[model samples]
Target chain A: MAPSIVVRDVLDREAVRRSVDTALADFLAAKARTATSQPQLGYLSGLLQDFMAGGKRIRPLLCATGWYAVGGGEDPRSVFQVAACLEMFHAFALIHDDVMDNSDTRRGRPTVHRTLAEHSAGRRGEEELERFAHSAAVLLGDLALTWSDELLHEAGLTPVQLGAVLPLLNEMRTELMVGQFLDLDATGGLTDDIEATLNVNRYKTAKYTIERPLHIGAAIAGAGAEAMAAFTAFALPLGEAFQLRDDLLGIYGDPGTTGKSRLDDLRAGKNTTLTALALRGADAAQTARLRSSLGNPLLDERGAADVREIFEATGARATVERMIDERHRQALAALEDSPFPFAPDALAALEEIAHLATVRNS
Target chain B: MAPSIVVRDVLDREAVRRSVDTALADFLAAKARTATSQPQLGYLSGLLQDFMAGGKRIRPLLCATGWYAVGGGEDPRSVFQVAACLEMFHAFALIHDDVMDNSDTRRGRPTVHRTLAEHSAGRRGEEELERFAHSAAVLLGDLALTWSDELLHEAGLTPVQLGAVLPLLNEMRTELMVGQFLDLDATGGLTDDIEATLNVNRYKTAKYTIERPLHIGAAIAGAGAEAMAAFTAFALPLGEAFQLRDDLLGIYGDPGTTGKSRLDDLRAGKNTTLTALALRGADAAQTARLRSSLGNPLLDERGAADVREIFEATGARATVERMIDERHRQALAALEDSPFPFAPDALAALEEIAHLATVRNS
Candidate 1:
């Protein structure tokens, strides 16, 4: 189950680009032709245009890595269809998530709901904004959802592969929805149970974001049980670290560079590692003030700064950073312990991912 | 490509039931072991426990028929997976639709959301009630979605057969979403265009409800292109009639029989056949009243009564009945044009379905 060191430099990016690009192009074309013989869903195929723009193809690369993990020969093109499924699935989540979180931007552009809300606002009154956002987001999510299945079908996997992937992919989708519910439930309810909150991230974010795609790719590549077990052990801790780092970025990273607000987590009062730390570290007086001011739907920038000051004073930032490093160490340790096929180049690239996720400015 | 009458009858009933039971039971058991496993979903599985209770099993039956139409053999067991997929998908649609429409009851039991919302009301606040309903509906939809893929995976068809089903199924899901959009878009938009309004139902409801399932069954059955084309021709009209008949029932049928209020459509000012007729036939005052009251979200029994009177006066019910008859005839005529191996028994059974859809009584 040794993975080979195939591409060392980014100059080999064309291979990865073609993998995703070919899928996207063929997907759009095939979708365009569907329902034509029936003449029902006129031009509905075009809903995909804006929804899929500018993905970095990271998921596809991860999928390729999963395939590589199974002692499978590299057929870069063969992984494209699977890669497309992962990417499309990611987009599907983003569409629904934007509505749930009321996010205004994605990547560098307005989120789907926000864009649609703005369009609705232009033609209508103020109250129409949220309603338009909800309605539009729902359909857009459906569009992304259907597109995922279509891409998966076109992946050219065998019957055995289909059996392996479809159920897992579908199960991933279900877990994602439940994970989102678990998260929303936790947000609405609470305990001192930090583990419960983290479980939400594991199901809601990590498994699909990391594990399932890896599993599907590996499964398709015919990874045996032992190989899968090793991969799982390596992926779980690494995945946890990935999400924890993402939460940190949400609160502390430069807004201009991230295309997201640094103060958003503060304004939203996300109960993340830093928030949990601040809560635990706060004195009675500080706790009351923090509790009273947090989760303000009407948060202003000044109010946001007030919250940030509390995070610093409470040692929350340092606590979260320490936790992040510990998890990262744990991730590397897991890889070392597991019998993963680590080509030197892959090992380096995987390390680079850890740095990019945890240490990069954006 | 010729379809047999005996085949359609058998597929329509016994085989369809077998598929639903086998696929659902086996799927639920397997899915429960996944990491995303839900103990509550087992309890919630009761929500679907009686799903097969009252359903005519028509869609599942149709899937088998479509498989046969596409050159599939009479190995009914082989078509089981596809049929399970059809039924699970329909169940998913139904559960979500009840939420969207705010239906209080389905199959004489409280709708899933209503059941949850009501249970939460006294124990929790209004917010909890809403969240419970929304979250439960989302989960139920997810369960149905997963079960569908599970069934498709086991459907015993070749990858090619599964591949064909995927695109069509996705298109149907897309159309259903688009139909939902079109329905919402028409909420306060132009309702004067009866044909346009009907297109939403045709695209959103009819195609998926009857046509696609039939096509899938025929496709899985290995019906050739000519048989498929014939199926498309017959199914489109028949499917349209099926919905049109249901719409009529919503306005004029007995609540005791339909398990739904006859006045509900009128109260909601639904843009169905009767409403369209009232628009076409009623005077200016009636039209203005209808426009103002549609989707008012407050119209009561008396108000609903007035709308019903208008429909009767305009003869909307009778016109729809005439259209239904014509549609049924067209569907039957279509079978004559195909080389479908629909043996005499199979043809008779399909014709019987045409009768069932259009007939006033059982």
Candidate 2:
């Protein structure tokens, strides 16, 4: 029997998410089917599928929105496929990030390395098995990266579209790596350099998470230079606001709602703008407490509470909230002044996205 | 004054290596120049440059050869750039492999992780420093992988050339990853499954090292089906023989000549065909001795001697030699009966590569 058809509106967030999910599922299914001789590939593909199921697909949503913002063409199939590629690339980034952070859980479940280690419980010594799991997870991340490229190549884009998109995609990948390196270099060291933290955010989040996705989608729709610049203006501030919300949530959000441990960022000694601002405003004793509590592997709930109290006492928390508000306003202003003349539905969708990104708890 | 021009012949192995090296150096130099704002990138690029200087450049040479074998066009610049891309990809693979194996050295120098760890000395505790180094090395490897793609995208190939090469490149990447997974899955265990070991060899070495590179170059030259098939037939057996020679060198070659510790493969208990054959032909006591010595981290020179004796006594070493000989002969036979009409110089170069690959001491 033929399947029931679901008419997907590009402006409908739920529909966009569902469409991207379907595209991703179909792509992975083909991969798994073709990997009959390599059973490990089938197994890895399943792992990736399960891992992907929990994502919010924010990048894909932005991509589709950006396409529409630039007066996208009739067919949305290739747009959806490219969106799936971005999601796959994200999976690669996250899998490697977890390995680097030595994180145990993601999305309220064991991380990829932890899952693999658990799967091989009795097959080898604990240490050996853990090492193997880490190595295998790295390989899996590489595969995801490779497959992301494959998805884009097979996304049915015309030569002109491919040509336009490839350079931006390359830039995005390199920028993310640069951001990751900066983040890694800054880890384990407490700093009061708010500008440096924002620099990291600009590359890691502003460009990678928001701007590039928008550019890629717009480019697919044959966006002009003015439209691309408009995307950057709208994207950068909103992306920063999104990350600021994420940092606050990392320390304050409810575990059940966020599906993440509040302590992970603190435990990793992440030098977020919030922490940097807090350090900048801290008194001597508060600074000492911040230094000891952050990046401590054995940091307890009591320690985190101490940190939150210090953040409040130093006015860092208030400052970050203010910063998020300012950025959100800037993003909206860009959209209002946009020279590209976005359609009414696209404009509405982008406004909603900017609002949700800035104010969301999770 | 103009620089002195050196005439380059693709069939000349040394000239091909030089051209590929020059291409890679130029690429990395451009990357370094562009990364002025990101100083870490410049530093990482320098590290990669040093790492690359030590490679054999075999893959690039073979790629160039394959291009010529199928009647290449006049301009060799794009071929060299693509060859550089392959070499860069190899760097990514080797960097990750060293991390997975926890190897200390490559080409008589510290491995990337070890070098990074040493560089970070005195900045952190030993364990933390080691962890950071490994993570950083993974990121660096990722950069290499990303840069490899950039190299290909910027290689100035016609759309038709790119269309021909991309699928083969993708398949090569996937094949390498699959081979790596299989090899990782088999580490730390001694098995008597000769066929299984050869399966790993076929993927890890045969296709990745030889066949796919040839296919990519041949595709760039728009090789007909008959020529592509002939390259595969010549490649598979020759690749297998090359790896078999490498296996012997890993266990028996002098450290001075091979620039690798002879004890590493034995200590890792690699499930090579030679080891598998030895297990298959071993007596009970010999088998027990083999099991104990192989994969033992503390295996010493005396223990290695014992394993070597077992290999000799069971004729496994001899059988591997015979296998290498047979494979080498088969590759030559395929070349002799090649369906594509090869130029005399190209045919001569392929024969030389085959002979040197199977019989080289290093």
> Which residue runs of candidate 2 sit more than 4 Å off their true CA positions?
A1-8, B1-8
| lDDT (tens digit, per residue) of candidate 1 on B1-362 | 11223344444566457556766776665555453454545545555655545566777766665665454565566566677777787787777666556667666567777876765566545755675566566556656765676677666777666666666777677777777766655544326677876787787667877788877776665556777677778888888888888887776677767777655455444576556766888788888777766656677777767776776777776777888889999999998776656666567667877777777531
lDDT of 2 by residue, A1-362 (tens): 01332323666778778778888888888888978777777888898998888888899989988888898888787888899999999999999999999998888788999998888778888777988899999999999999999999889999899999999999899889889989988887788999999999998999999999999999999999999999999999999999999999999998887878999999889999999999999999999999999999999999999999999999999999999999999999998999878878888889999988988866
Question: How far out, in Å, is residue B180 in model 2?
Answer: 0.5
Q: TM-score of each candidate? A: 0.89, 0.97
Please list the residue runs of candidate 1 whose C-alpha ends up more than 4 Å from where it truly belongs after superposition. Answer: A1-18, A33-47, A54-56, A69-74, A121-129, A262-270, B1-15, B33-54, B66-74, B119-125, B128-132, B261-269, B360-362
Q: Which DockQ values do the candidates obtain, in the order shown? A: 0.39, 0.74
Residue-level lDDT tens digits of model 2 in B1-362 = 01231324667777778888887888888878878777777888889999888888888888888888898887777887898999999999999999998888888889999998888888878778888899989998998998899889888899899999999999899889989999988886678999899989998999999998888888888988999999999999999999999999999998888888989899888889999999999999999999999999899999999999999999999999999999999999999998888878889888998998899988
User: Model 2 chain B, TM?
Assistant: 0.97
